[model samples]
Every structure is written in structure tokens, then in C-alpha cells.
Target chain A: MSDLSDERIREEAKKALREKGLKCVIGWSAEGTPTFASTEEEIDRLSFNRSCVNNLVPYLTYEIRSQRGKTRDGKDKVVVPVGVVVRGCDSKALLLLLNEKILARNEVFIIGVPCSGVVDPRAGGALFRKCVKCAMRNPVVFDVLASETVQEDEKDYSEVEAIERMSQEERWALWEEILGDCIRCHACKRSCPVCYCDECLLDPTDVAIKPDTTAEEKAHRPLWVERSVNVPENLVYHLARLPHLVGRCVDCGECERVCPRRLPLRLLTTKLEKDVKEIFDYEAAKEEGQKPLIAMSCMEDENGFIM
Target chain B: MSKSILRKDKVAEALSALGKQSVVYAPVKNKRGIVEYRELGKSASAAEIELDGKPDTPPKAIIFPQTEVLLTYRKDKDGKFEVTPARPDEREKVIFGVRPCDAIGIAVMDKVFCGGKFTDPYYKARREKVTIFSIACDGPMDSYCFCPSTGGSPAATEGSDVMMYDVGDSYYVEGVTEKGKKALEALKGQLGKPSPEQEGRKEAIVEKAKSGEGFTRKISAESIAKLDNSFDSKYWDDVARRCLSCGACTYYCPTCHCFDINDEKGGERVRTWDSCQFGIFTMHTSGHNPRAVRAQKLRNRYYHKFKYSKDNIGRYLCVGCGRCIALCPASLDITKAISEVK
Candidate 1:
């Protein structure tokens, strides 16, 4: 994909709506954040820059009911095709979504844009942790190429290796300090692109309870986790989310970016991503019919940690 | 009214002196480099008190914590259930270096938690035990501020015990309440009387602060008048399309006071900060939800800020601190949304 000028990208966004008949185009608004553009006038407000950091792929999920339009018929309701602007990382999220059968590849018209790297607002021009080690700066898949694909250097997993080298006690202490900062605000889970469960397993309502318990007692019962915000419970909540995102997380770093506490969540998720690469010899969102690493694992897996 | 002048060099001394008498919470940098309000004692730095702009986290947590245990329940040997209420910290504390908008945020929260017929005992206990020492903003901290638009000025003194104005080398402080007067007495000899020229300088500073800078966004009374009719408009669907429904905006907001009370392990009851943007915020025990759609949830945020808060409390819920604008991943600027109302 060739790098399209920010103006050219905006122009193409309008074209997608007018010519391609997309119900709406999702891109950066004049406010320098993700916006939905349905008309030419609204598309005129679309602009892109280094500050456009949000992965727009998450909005495609049904958790946000407004994004899914009304069905024409009772059962097989036809959804209007949605046009989305995707950076390098966002393109991969789309790929993973397509592989999971969550989204039909033809349902979305993608405008893939090549990138140098996005600026971290907190660090003021410094690349985000995920972008710093990004192996791909060009979209892996797209319908419309916004930029000519550019070559980029690959990143080594030194950060994950450093954490892997830590003693078990040292690692526990590190996680305790980090997760202690978590307020259980759920910002990280909510901002994730691949966390699309309609009712998350962590929700207390979804937990099974004894049949004899009353409604009030059912609400108060601790199934797997307590409502407390202690370090242990917070760790359970975060660590639980990592497995669900195992082969799906695009490492977009939206979770870390949106965290009010500024918890370095990428540290944990990236380790899982690296493990998937090492153990199963698989990288996420690379091809068309690719399955998740966990979905294709074998019984002869290494037991290095069992000792 | 007791008056005092606090020099820049003496800030540390004054804070340390105040700390000896009562706990003091000032903005200090955490290990992550984010400035948040922390207690002014062992391991905390008094020099890191951010006075130039709003701190990353507001001082509301001092009164209403992010998460608090309301009560601890246990069963006795006789198998009878017993509940013990959790007591709040009764020690007096001072909130130092709070910006005017955040100070107004405390005042707004007071209406919700303290003004109604039934007051939140937890919030009231903490609110009464704390003293607010607000630093009047000389101008908007950044381009996102719109305090004046919401009937609040940069130099507003709605919720402060002591209001301090920066005038050259020192701060011209005036005690606004009896509690402020008592606190000022501790710094009696350390302070000096301001000269007429210094008083004039303070007036000039307040005037400039009151006449806020040119803001990129504006929301007037007229624009919000017809905000109700726009509830069903397609504009909400468009905005909702891009909204990630993350709690960053509401959690970081200074005046958002919504909370959820739940039972933890050992039957301990706790209340934690919850956001309306979450899909399950309005989910009932019966599995019914009034605001099931994301559009309604998004609309409810704006309506609560502009319409519902005003009708119920006679004041807008938002203090225009701009945390929502600055932190939103989708750039869902409330100021832009408000201007587009009607």
C-alpha cells in the first residue's frame, strides 16, 4: 500500500460513502480522534495524523448495538456494509476478526493506510511500547490501498525475555505492584478490539449459583472473583482477560493508552503473544483462513515450567 | 477574614508545618510519571505539587474514593448474621494545589452527595474532615477548558476554604471560611501583609483569569435549550458508532459521581466508581435494561451533564475541566457535542 496524503485519505473516505454505498465511514474526525462519517459534509471533517491512535475495529462488534443496523427480515437481516480506515495494527485486528468468523470478509470495505508510527500523547512524540516493537508498519490486508507498502525493521522480543528471566517471586512482586494500581475500571477490557463477548464471563450475573440462593444472595455471591479492588482480585481480572485475548489481540495498545492509571498492560499481553510465536510457531492475523494458536495446539507441548 | 502571603520558597515549609497538624494531600508524581493527589507524608514529595494546571486525577477521591468498603459482614458462632459498618478516616486533611475547575467539581459533587434530603454519610464525613486550598488558574490550562461557559470562571471560589492568587513571587491567600481562618493562623508569623500594589496585581490576575482565553469549543445556554429534542436525532447514532464505550472519560471526569455497590468476599459490601458508558451499567437483575442501546448510553452522558443535572440540582453536572476531551480515544469532545446540540 502506498502512503496516501491525509487529504487523499479523507477524499477516499467520502468516495467510499458516495460511490461504494457504505452506510458509514469510520476514521479520524477534525478533533483528531476516531469519528463516523456518513455524508460528504461529515466526511469533510475527517482528518488523519499521528494522534489517530484508536483501533476502530472494536466498534464493529455487536456489544455496541448502534454500530449494528436493524435487520430487514426477522432472521437473515441484511446489514449495510461499513467502511473503516485501518492503520497497520487495526488491519490485523480486522484479519483476526474475519478468521474467528465474527465478521464476513465481504461485510466490511477496508481502507488500509501504511504508517511510520503513531505518537504517544503521554510521551509527546515518542512511539508507544507496542509500536516501538511493531514488526509490521504496513497493513497486512486491505481492499483499498491508502499507501504503497513500505519496508520496516523487525523488533526482537527482548522486553518479554527480560520479564521471562525474572525469578518467580520477583515476577509476582512486579505484577502485584502493577496490578495494585488497577481500580477495576475495566478501561483495558472495554478498549480491546478482540474482546467482543456479549456477556463477559467475569460479569457476576453470568456466574452460576446454588439453586437455593435468593436473588439478593445470588447477586452478592462471589463466583470466581470478589467485587473488591485488592491486588489479588485485580490480578485475577486482568490475567483472566489475557487468555481470552491469547491468539486474537492485535497488540494495538489501545488498552494501555486508554488506562487512566497508565498501567503497562502490553507487558503482559505481549508476553502471551511472544509465547504463541515461540510455542506454536504462529503469528496472529497473518493470512486468510488462519486459526488461533490455541485452537490448533498439540498434546506434545513443552513442559519446561513443570519442573 | 484572615489574610496571608505564601512565598514560593516557603511552600515546602508551609506544607510540612501543615502536615504536622493534619494530613495533607497534594499532587505528586507517581512512579509512572503521572501526577495524582497523594498524602503529604513519608515517601511523598511536597515539591511536586502541580499548581500550573489540573492534576491527572482529581481530588474527589479524597472525599469519595474510587473503591471503599461500606461494611463487613460475618456470621457469629450462633449462626446469626452480623454487619459492621466501615468507618471513614476522620483525620483532618488539606487538599493543596487544586485548580479552580476541580474545586468547582467538589462543589458540584456536594450538591449530589450532600445537598439532597438524604446525604451520603461516607462522603459527608470525608468532605467535612478535609480543607480545600484551591489555586486560582491565571488562564485556561490548555485549549480544552470551558469553565466560564458552564457558569464557572478560572478564578471562581465556589468550593474552597482558602483561595490563593499568584502574584509575582508569592501567593496572595484569603481565607474564605472559618476553617480556612483557623488553618491560616498556623502560618501567621511565616506570612506578610500584601502591599496595595501587590493587591492590585492580584486583582489584575483574577480579571485575566475570569476573562478566559479564546476556546476552540463553545456551549451556550441557547444551544442546550433544545438538547432534549436532539436525543432521537441521527447525530447520536453517528457519535455512538465510533464510541468505544470505555470508562476513561467518565472515570477521569471530575464531576461524574455514578457508583455501584456490590458485595465482595466474606460478605463485605463495597462501593466502587462505575461509568454509564459500560454496557452493563443499567442491566437489571431481571435481565431487563432501560438503556440497552449504546446511543442511549452516550446520549445519557450529555443529558446528565447539561439537562438532567440542571433540572434536578439547578446546576450543570460538568465543570468543563476538559479531561473528557483530552483523554477520549475517539475524540468525542463534549464541547463539540454540546455546540452541535439542537
Candidate 2:
């Protein structure tokens, strides 16, 4: 696909605020960070480039809703629709949000861009690891395309294949080395658009651990996951998050990019992504109104083991 | 006030000599070109030590490990529970190649862990066993450094036992304390007097480090003071809108000391690093969180660094290392945020 000029994208964002009445156009700044352009000046500051790497769909949740305007009357709050510029990866997240009923279809206006690839800021403009094997260069769902749709290369699972070739012990050792360095920052889960749980199960306070409380008194508190930075706890914390991501993960690569330790978190998610595609014969966010693989009937699934 | 010069070539000999008495840690780049502070191997020399800039992770882990077992309890044969302290392997240690900002960060942490009424015995034990060798930065390590603004210089030697200034092919070392003086005396044979040219170069480097060139940004005391009254400012909401609430900024920070203690199946009680950026950091047992909002939590971090720590310890918690600025996923630059504080 041909790239849309930055100026053109800026003008379109400004128009969305003024003409289409968007509360804000979630776009990019010149420094390649997320910018919420609510006014003309902010829209003027909006920029788009190969370095715009953030997936802005995570901002639409109630967690960020405090930034919205409030009314004096004690009435149900009416949310203003926001315009968001999306690359193929972000549009996939948006589709998952729409499919999960977490977000209303008409609530967000997606300004889709046909992305060739985004550059890793840390790697000096090299294509990000997640982008190298991308099968969706065009937005999965968009209200308008900023440019013509781009042709996507056939998906390559070579990286996933190499991991599969590893023996079970070797796979365990690889993950042990990777997760050993995790600081438990939760950057991976926080950056994930599909990980919208208000209280994550991995959080220590969320998992209840009552050890035979008396009839009137409770002593033991909840401890879901141990608060150590060692291998066993970190490994369990990462693997437990996979069940929640069954068919919803978009392989956006934001998790790995945000990691301070630069751990290979995407490799784990990519493994799951490949498994879902092969077993369920489903791809995440491919089309609107489709049920997620976890939500669909098992009878239709190609995995006979489930039957 | 003892001073001497050590040639770059003889650094390996000095390290080898020091290794006989103490475990030596130096910054070394991994296969991925990411620098980390690790213990020197038996065959490794000072050539492997990277003194050019700060490591990706600070040397705070040397004194306060990412995970530490406080104590372990075991059921004896008599059916009584016996508790034993899980003491770290005691060893005299040297951490070389720590930047001045990071060394200052250790001093700031000192104020928290050692200055209070209740000192952490675990941290105190480890800290008392380690000596610091702070290397001077000739100029700005990168585009994000701001040591001068935080009452630190690239040549500041606040917490280091010895300050080593990079002067071309040699290092001009000066002992700042009794410990440093003792270490210098021990390595007297490996050291030599600085030549006139080397002394001149050292002075020039110190001057350049003091110049504003090393600091591309500023976080003035006035701006920091303004933060005291700006808790409810809409600026926080704007700044934190894109924040993923990832703990990268706090985790990579040299002075962040928040921690959580938990018990494991092996009857081990462990304390590990925790971050205020996490949602459950302040979650109440009754499900009442005073700072449940993400913006509120982010705001508290700035206040703690610039306001609360100053109130408690008479020093800002942040040492202007710029790790938070460089690693924040949303590009939430603390220096930029400081400028925006009204």
C-alpha cells in the first residue's frame, strides 16, 4: 500500500474533530508517542510515520474514562465517540474489542492506515520482530482507509516452527531463561488491548486464600501469585495470562517493545496464535461480528481431541 | 585526599588483585549489546568492563537484590517450628563502572534504608560489605541525561568510595572517604602519579561534565515545589492518558525502593521489588484503594520523587539518570513533565 503523507493524516484528524465531532483523535506525536488531539492545535501536532508503534485501542476502556468531560447533573454519563488512527495491528485489537462486546461498533471511528511495517525505535528503524511475519497489512475493520490497501505477504510460522522443533525440556529451558529476567512489571498485560480485566487474576490481592476461617472471623488474605522475581513464579504468571488470550491476541508486539529487560514475550503469544489458527481454523479479528474461537461451539472446531 | 593515576592497560591487573579479596562486579554488554552489571568471571579482565555509560539496569540490585529471602521456617523432628534467617553469602565486594548518577542514587537509597528509625538489616548487611567505584561521565551519556538539575554532576562522587575520572588513556582516581583511602593504599603498587597533561585533561573533563551540555533538560526546584499544590491539575490526566502503567520506569530506576514480601511453599519469606505503577501496589484488603486511578498513581510517583522524599530525607529521590525517560513506553518524559508543572 502507498503511505499517506503525515500532513494529510493531520488534516484528516483535524477534520474528524471539527466536521465529524469526535471528542478526540488518538494519533501520534512527532516523537512517536500517543497523542490525543482534542483541539486544532493538538491536531496540528499530530504526526504519522513508520515509528508510530503504539496500539491506541487500549485507551478506549473505562480505566481511561476519567479524562472525559463530566456534567453537573446526576445523570447517566454519555460517552463522546473518539476518532483513532489505526495500523493493521491496532484494527485487529479494535475488532476483538468489538467482538467481545467490550466496545460498541459505532462508538469508535477507526482511521485505518495500510501499514507496510512499523520501525522499532530501539533497533534503529529496523522492522519490528512482530511485523516480519505479519499476514495482515490492511486494517481488519476500518470506517475509512487513509490510503489504498496494501498486499500482505503469506504468513510464515518459521520462528514458531523452530520453537516447536525444540524438545519439551529444551522448550522449558528456553522459557526458563526468558522468564527468569522478568521483573513482573506487568507491561505485557497492561499494553495488551484485550487484557481489560479490572483485577487481573495474576495480581496477588485478587486470588483469595482463606485457610479455614472461623465462623465470624477471617484471617488469611488472598495471594494469587507469589511476589518473588524468581523463575517459577514469573513463569506461572506469564503462562496463566495465555488462557485469557486464547483467540483474542492480535500479536501487536507492544508487550515486548515495552519490556525494560527486552524479554521475548511475543514468542509465547505467537505460539498460542499459531495453535489457535491451526486447531480452530480461525484468525483473530479477520471480520466483524464473528464469534471468538473460545466462544464458538467446539463441535465445529477441527481439534478432535476436544470432542 | 589521596590521588593517583592508573593506566587503562593496568586496570586488569588492579581488578585481578582486587578479586583476590573481594567479588568484583563490572558492567558488561550481553550478546544483544544490552549492558548489564554482572560479577566478573575468573578469566574475565577489566577490558570487559564498560565504563562509557550507565548499564541498562542499575547496580541497586547489588545491594538490594530483585529477590531476597528474609527467613526460612522448618518443622523440626520435635514438631516445633524453627525459624532461621536466610542470610546472604557474606563477602567483601566491589562494584566498578557505576556512573556518578547511579552512585548518588545509592546514597539516596541509603537515606531511606539506613537513615530511618527502623533500618533494614538485610540491606544494611549487604551495603556494608560493598564498596563503590564511580566512573565520571565526560559529557552527556545520551540525549536524556540531566544530572546537574538534580543536584548532581557527571563528576559528582556522593556515594562512591573512589571517583575515577576518565582522562584519555588513564583514569585519575581520588579517594573521597576512609574506605576509599584504604583501598587506594592497598593498590598503591598498581597506581602512579598523574602527569601534568593527564591532570589537565582530568580538570577539563570535570569542567565539561559540570557544563549544561550534559543536561539537555531541566527539572528545577521551583517546578518541583509547584507539584506540591498541583495534585488535582488536569495536566496529570493528560500526561498519564497514554501511560500503560508499566513498571519499567520504576523498575529501571536506581532509587525506587517499594517492595512486597510473600511466603513460598519452602517456608521462605521473600521480599522483592515492587512498583507504585502497579494497580495492586496500594490495593486495600477491604477493596478500598485511595489511589485506584491510574493518573493518581502516576501523580504520586512524581510527588514521591520530587516532594515526599525531599520532605523526609532532604534530598530528591530522583538522581536524573534518565532511565525513566528513556524506557517509558508512552514516552512520559519526567524532565518534560517537570517543565509542564505549573
Candidate 3:
């Protein structure tokens, strides 16, 4: 579908929120709305703007746990269910939550739309570069699919193919070149939906290697070796992020879009996803009840190299 | 000693009959030597078992799935929350043709999940309901198998309830548990008892496995105890630099059991697998990360298996199932790393 048609779907979602007896419809709207108007208004639906790029599931979780009720006069006042609008990839996030037993499936109303994909506003251009090549133009697991027709065309992974064409040394060189600009800001991690760790290992205090040491001293320390944005550090950092996405990353391209340097983060994830499918014959969040590809093992699993 | 001599042709009929009585999962070959579990249809042949070598994936998938719904919740209009248990169907399952190393891995997992303070009821329910029918490995399937060094034998009976050995013209089955006795009793009258020669053949197979190059790498378990003191050792940095940290090693490992809990509100909650190898695996809400670098993250993966799990579970988390050696893109081998640890 075109940009004009997507706006129409957004309007329909707004109309659904305007219906009677609905507590609040959660949909994307313009950014910069006043917090009071966004939360306290008695309007039919709540819309987020382009900054709403983060999956609504995490925010919904926060709301469900913290704002679900109020105590008045020693009695509890009930909070209404929040209606959420999700795209195909967003729906997969919701499904993963359900599968993990973190959230009940029936608590929130999902308005699923056939997503043509959304532009990452953090890319700071006409649109996020990755959005132009996105394949999931239509959502698969939505309660209310916005599009009538599904786009089943094969995604052109030429961008990844272009990188794959390079030799291993060349690929490593490219990664080093890109990661050299990393400030370790971790905006990419914070914006990710699947990155729901209670404690991140990057925090020096959490793992407690040494918090008082200088960067130069820490860099030479055995535990802190390869911790910088140098080639070795960048390679390790990039490699460390791949398994987190196994059977979970929906190829949303959110990380790349949010990166300050616009490093091709999605390519690394997508390449791993491709290998996972090829090696294990599995897809991440493709089927509702399908097992996480990485969790299961067999005794007969081929171990030809270790012997 | 008990022995049965069924013609190779009758093996299919025997397995088919067994399937009629219980849930039977066996390895079926697909492309690229990949192995997957398929229901044993009435006419399914034993030829589908692929006993010539190890399957690409382990049997842990059958018992401990990658992702399983633990419970479901519904919020009534009255705003009261109701939780519904999501349990797997109670069915007696027989995992036929499991390898010795894989079976031991399951046994290790059983100790970890079942004996812990927080019992995984889902895993327990499946464990209590399933019976393992282990097939002894006659020869090394690949170079990555270091079963000998890690206390694994090709034909070890450490985990299997019933151990099976393939003789030239017949199959010999021995009962190692009461469950195996009952299964054997059920199969009585259709087979001859074990002869002295069959028992001799079993010993020969076990001996062959013992002498193979499977134990090429000898790691002193005591050396792993020094890992705590070596926390800041340069060894981790060297390994971490080579590690892609892609989690293939942990994910494919038979004993790595870290997971993450998430709430997907349609009204239900879910929990999925998490890996310690990721930068965000231990990320805290306060915006601090404990394993910010690949070196630390990589160190956690080994230290947890060798030190913490041994302290808690009474054994190293690794069961000598050498998946990490075979599937690593960068050729990072755990056995080689462990050999170099000291």
C-alpha cells in the first residue's frame, strides 16, 4: 500500500477508539502531545507519534503492572483494559510475551494491522534506510488486519547479499570501520523490545569487574580487554548481540534505525536469522506454538568436529 | 542379562507395536543430515531411525521445548484476575534411539530443573511421563564428540532406562530400571532370551567406544575450580575476542538453561529462553549493564557452566555434548578452550 492509504488505516483505528465503552485505544499519533492530554483525557483513543517506534507491548506492560488500579478509602478502584494497536512484528512481540507467561493473552484488546513497515524517525532523513527494503508489508497476527490484501512477494535481501559477497577479511574490515564510531551510548539497546534484561552486563557495577579504574587501565586489564570501540572490541560487541535475537528478533530493523552512526545492525541480526533457519530449519516467531529453535537439543545432534 | 533376536525386518513391526502403546519419538533424517522428531506411524520402519550416526539436533527438544506456555490468565469484568494452568497433555512417551551422551544430558537437566527450589513443573510433568530407550553408539559419528573425556561412553547406561545393542543379525535389550523391566515384560513371548554371545557383543561395543579417540582431550575437573580466582585472567579476553557471541553455542548446548520472562497482554503472560552471552542478558532497569563487553559475557557462559552450575547442581553444566564445536561459525571449540584454561 501507499503512504496515503496507511493514513486512512490510522484514521480507521482512531474511529474504533471513539466507539462507546472503550477505556482507551492505544495507537500511534503525532509526537510532542502534552503528557496531561495523552494520559488524563477522556478521549476515545490514545495515539503516539513517530517517536512511538518502540513496540507498544513494553509500555503496555508497564501500564498493566503500575497503573492498573488505585486504592480509595481502603478499597481498590478498577482500571479499564487498554486497547493496543500492533503491526505484524509488534503482534509477534505480543505473542512472545504470551508464550513466556509474562502477560495474559485476553487482558488487552489487539488491533492488528497489515504493516507496510514504519520509518525510524531516529534515522534523521526522509525515512529510515532499512524501511525501504522491508518485506513484512502486511501484518500476520493482528486481531483487526488493516489491509485487505497480503503482500507475499519475496523480500529483496540485496543489501545483505552485497555484504556477503565480500570475503571474511573484508567483512571484518567493514565492521571495524563502522563500529569505530560507536560511542557506546547504547541507544540501540534501550529502544529494543526484546532487550528486556533486569540487569545488563555492560554496567560495570552490576558485574563488578572494576568500577574505579580509568578507561586506559581498564582497556589493558584482562577482564576489560577488547572493551573499546577498536576493531577487537567492536567485533566482540557485535558478536555478543546476535544470540539475544535468536528465535525472538522479528527483523524489525529498529536497532539500525536508532543507531546514532546508522551502523547496519539489522544486517548482522538478519544474517544470523538466515543461518538459523538454514541450519535448524526454524524461524523466529513464525508460528504461534512452534518451539524456540535454540532451546531444544537432541543426543543424536551431530558433533563431528569435537572428536 | 536379557536378549531378544528379532530379524532386522521385524524391527519395524516391533517399533510400530510399541508406538501403539505409547508416544514414540524417533529421529527422521531430512536434508543435510539434520534430525527431527516425527510421530511413529503404524507402518513406520526402523530404517528411519538413522542409527549409523548422530543426528544434527539433540533430543532435548522433545522434552524441553524451545518455547512453551506456562500458564494463561483472564481478567474478568469484575477486575479480578484468574490464572489457568497451561500444562502439556499427560501421555506416556518413549524416546526411541536416544544417544548415550544426549540421555546423560537429559539426566543432568533433570537434576537441575527437578531438584531446584523452583521446580519447573512443565519439565517435571514431561520427565515423569516419558521413558528413555537408549541406543548404544557403535562408532564415533564425528570429530566433535569428546564424550570419553567428559565421563561419557558411546554405550554408557548412565541415563537410559533400557539400553539396546545391535548385533550382527539381532538386537539385544537390557533393562536398567523398573520401568524398563515393565516394558520388557510387555514385550515377552515374541522374542528369545539373551544368549551368552549377545552379552559378549555388548561388551565388545562398549569396549570399542572406550578405546576410540572420543577421549582425546583430558580436562581436569579440579582445574575448573580455579576459574573463580582467574576471573580477571587474560584467558577470557583471548577467547572472547574469537567468540562471535552469537549465542549459537549456548542455544545449541544441551544444558544451558537461562531464560527471560515477558508479559504479552492479550490477557496472558509468557516466558521464553534467554542467553547469558548477550550484552543485554543481564541489563538492569537502572540503565547499567553488568556484561557490557563480549569478554565478560563470554566469561559468564563458561564460568556459569564450570563453576556456578557445579556449585549449585553438583556437576558441571556441560555434558560433553560437543555442539559448540560443530556449529560455531568462527571455529571456536569449547573443548579446546577448556584444555587451554589452565
Report the number of the highest-DockQ candidate: 2
Native contact recovery (fnat) for each candidate is: 0.46, 0.60, 0.00
Where is model 2 chain B poorest over a 10-residue stretch in terms of lDDT? B283-292
Q: Write the per-residue lDDT of candidate 2 for residues B158-216, one digit (tens) a residue.
A: 99999999988899998887887877776877899999998898899888876756466
Candidate 3: regions farther than 4 A off = A1-307, B5-7, B42-47, B210-214, B221-228
Error of 1 at B82 (Å): 1.8
DockQ of each: 0.43, 0.46, 0.02
Give lDDT for model 3: 0.63
Error of 1 at B139 (Å): 0.8
Instruction: Tell me the deviation in Å of residue B115 in model 2.
Output: 1.6
**Model 3 over residues A1-307: C-alpha lDDT tens digits?**
3444345445554554454233555555444121111232423223433334545555455444444455867665554555666666677776776565555555566666665545443334344555565566455555565556456446557778899999999987777777764534354664565666544544221233344545665345333222222455455555676766776777766566445445678887778767667666766767566576556656765456468
Task: Give the better candidate number (1 or 3) by TM-score.
Answer: 1
Give the alpha carbon lDDT tens digit for every residue of A181-255 in model 2.
788877777888888875665866332222343434424443457878788888889998887788889887778
Which ranges of candidate 1 are over 4 A from the true structure? A1-20, A44-47, A62-74, A203-223, B214-216
User: Where does candidate 2 clash, by residue pair?
Assistant: none
DockQ of 3: 0.02
Per-residue lDDT tens digits of candidate 3, residues B1-342? Answer: 345654455666667667767878887774323465555763244668765567656778678765566778888999998998786759888888788888888888888889878788888888887788788888666667777666677888876888888876777788778887667665664556767888788779978987854455455655665676888888776565534345556656777767655444454455545667665577654546778776799888878877887788887777676777765533456776766774
Task: Give all candidates' CA lDDT scores.
Answer: 0.79, 0.81, 0.63
Score residue A293 of candidate 2 by CA lDDT: 80
Model 2 DockQ, alpha carbons vs. true complex: 0.46
Residues A195-264 of candidate 1: C-alpha lDDT, one tens digit per residue: 8766566643232233354788746654566656688788888888887877777777788888878888
Q: Name the runs in model 2 displaced over 4 angstroms.
A: A1-4, A18-20, A62-77, A205-222, A297-307, B42-47, B75-80
